[model samples]
Target: MIYTLERTQFFTCGLDEAWAFFTNPNNLATITPDTLNFKVLDTFDTPEIYEGMIINYHVTPLLGIRLSWQTRITEVVPRASFIDNQEKGPYTLWQHTHEFFAEDGGVRVKDTVRYAMPFGVLGTLVHKLIVKNKLREIFDYRQQTLEKILNYPAHD
Candidate 1:
């Protein structure tokens, strides 16, 4: 079964600034939870994100067992949206779309992730028991971290 998660965050910055901050690979670690030990391993040919870019990372999501993940940038619309698909990762299928819109002198960022686990029924069980909540927590951490880094007031 495929599971979907969506989150939206409003930043006190314009679309261009928010787009630049989010697309820069170096800023990922700052937004991600430190417990994940997320590290990007690739040296990009260009600092600017573009279609067909492949990003590699090592992350420890659970049980202190590190995993290597590779994702390809499938779509890019500057200051608008981007989509990333998992090329190699724990999930059998992982596709995440990030969108930006101008809102109240800032930008409203929306993230939608669609993913499926490897196992069949067991994966569904895991999703209910653990994966779902874990994903929410991760995104929650990201929202707080981003707000702090961007100097935006936190929301409830």
Candidate 2:
């Protein structure tokens, strides 16, 4: 079961600020949907994410089932884009590409994910029944959360 999802968001902030927000793993726990119960267990090297860096996390996307998630930064292009691939996680293959562009008043951000799950035929069933919607919801929450964070200053 191969699944791909792409989403774009416009933010009223500069490219550098946008890139800084996304590239910083610490902020991930904030934007991620609360339903996922996402938490970063071990931190990766800070400032810039380079290839071969591992991020360890624990999430409970489903009820009471804690999942150990791990992903590696497979590619990086400074403030332009980066790709992270799942090394050990829920998916059989999960690759997410984050691209940032300077728009008129801010930055245009795009997230593209290409993934597949385990269990072959059964994975397709799971995707249709649960994973697909879960992914959509997560990204939707992300957009809203980011908008609030980027629009308001720290003191706000």
Q: Per-prediction count of colliding residue pairs?
A: 0, 0
Residues 58-153 of candidate 1 have per-residue lDDT tens digits of 999999999999999999998899999999999999999999999886989999999999889999898999889999999999988888765556
For candidate 2, lDDT tens digit of each residue in 1-156?
Answer: 678999999888899999998888888899998777899997555766788888899999987799999999988898899999999999999999999998887889999999998998888898999999999999999999999977645343
lDDT of each: 0.89, 0.89
Residue ranges of candidate 2 with Cα displaced over 4 Å: 152-156
lDDT for position 52 in model 2 = 83
Q: Residue 145 CA error for candidate 2 (Å)?
A: 0.4
Could you tell me which residue pairs clash in candidate 2?
none
Q: Pick the candidate with the highest TM-score.
A: 1
Which pairs of residues collide in model 1? none
